[model samples]
Target: MQETAYAKINLALHVRSRREDGYHELETLFAFVDRGDTLLAKRAEQDQLQVVGEFGGALDDPFGNIVMQALGSLPRPDGLAITLEKSLPVAAGLGGGSADAGALFRLVERAQGLPDDWRQRAAKLGADVPACVESVTCVGRGTGTDLEPIDSDLTGTPVLLVNPRVPLATGPVFKAWDDKDRGPMPEGTAREIAEAGRNDLRDPAISQCPVIAEVLAALGKSEAWKVEMSGSGATCFALFNDVEARDAAARAMPSDWWQMAGLLR
Candidate 1:
């Protein structure tokens, strides 16, 4: 079976407070884009994961991979060979890896009946895995594992994703987060993500990787409704009023950066 591991985009991320386990308490609106990696799994005698794509080499060890951790979570009666087509930029704050694990978990759940505590098991793979499993708009709280589904109607919303190709790790960015919070997102459905719904990681991420700012500025040059960095850094998205404008901006984007335009699902 094959599945598309959609990229996880943070429409708005707010780092609420630091937790006891050194992780930050966060509340962010999570959304998935059409652009992302693809996973193909098949039943085989020996189980193994073969990654093939631009950033596949970065994950040298498969054992320590989230995909492997997910398989370990549930007992597979039949060994399966999984191939990951790494299309999304790694560590670019698009949740490429987390989404991959989440996609695999879904595949496993269907192939082999997963446990009732599957959501928690998915969380064990990573904090973001649980939300990625659903691959929809959600409010991520606590360590980002505690999820509360939100009814967001972004049907015709045009979005353009641009990245400078710089991989910014989340750990350092969180450490660089300011003393003050970005305040919590007001309770309600966000048909259109408000400009006030800010991304707290922006400042620190920009401080570390200035190119991200440049991408944001590039997107700003266009007539977008709202433009901001997606997650930690690098990958910034511009929500245009329509798909035509968004696609035009994406096509005109500099070759130095990676860009993709699509209507939000």
Candidate 2:
């Protein structure tokens, strides 16, 4: 079986409260984009995984991956060989790891009856895993596991994603957050999902990785409808009403930064 591990982009993330457990309570709008990694699975004599693509080599240990951990959580798992096309930037606040893990979780559940406590299982893998499993626009809260599906349609919304080759780890971004101004959620039709959007993590993330500021600055000047950092840092996006305008903006973007333009998926 094969599945696309679409990148999870935070339309708006507001850090609300930090718990005694060190988990931050947040309110954010999550959306999946067409541009991301892909996964393929096939039954094999022994379980294995091979990584490839732009950021494949970023992982230090392939066999001891989250995919393997997902399989281990299954009951009497059979041998399977998996291939991951790591197209998305690793540790760049794209939720690449959680997307991969969620895809595998679905694969195992489809082949074998899913566990009763699937949400809990997904949450165990990572805070974003449950959201990734849903694979749609959701209001994420409570360390990002409490998901409430919402109506969203970016149909012809053009998007240009620009990532300065720097990876911003989530830990530092949270640590740098002032934990103030945990704003209210955005409200609007599906077409204008981010009309009231705000990302509290943006400033802190930019503080951690200064290059991210440069990216946002470039995107801001593009004359797009709106431009903001997606999750934490590095990967900032400019939204346009149409593809023609988005493509033109992409063409004008810096060549050194990673750039891709497509309709919001």
Residue 152 deviation, candidate 2, in Å? Answer: 0.7
lDDT for position 21 in model 1 = 86
Q: Candidate 2 residues 100-163, lDDT tens each?
A: 9888877776677677888898889889999887678788888899998787777456788889
Models 1 onward score TM values of 0.95, 0.94
Clashes of each: 0, 0
Each candidate's root-mean-square deviation in Å? Answer: 1.4, 1.7
Worst 10 residues of 2 by lDDT: 184-193
> Candidate 1 local accuracy as lDDT?
0.84
Alpha carbon deviation, residue 198, candidate 2 (Å): 0.7
Off by over 4 Å in 1: none
Model 1, 1-265: lDDT tens per residue? 9998888888888888887889888888888887688999999886799999987988888998788878878887888899998888888888888999889888987897778899888887778889898898888888889898777777557888898888899889989987686578766566444466889899999999998888988888998988889889779998877888898888778998887676676
Query: Ten-residue segment with the worst summed lDDT in candidate 1?
Result: 187-196
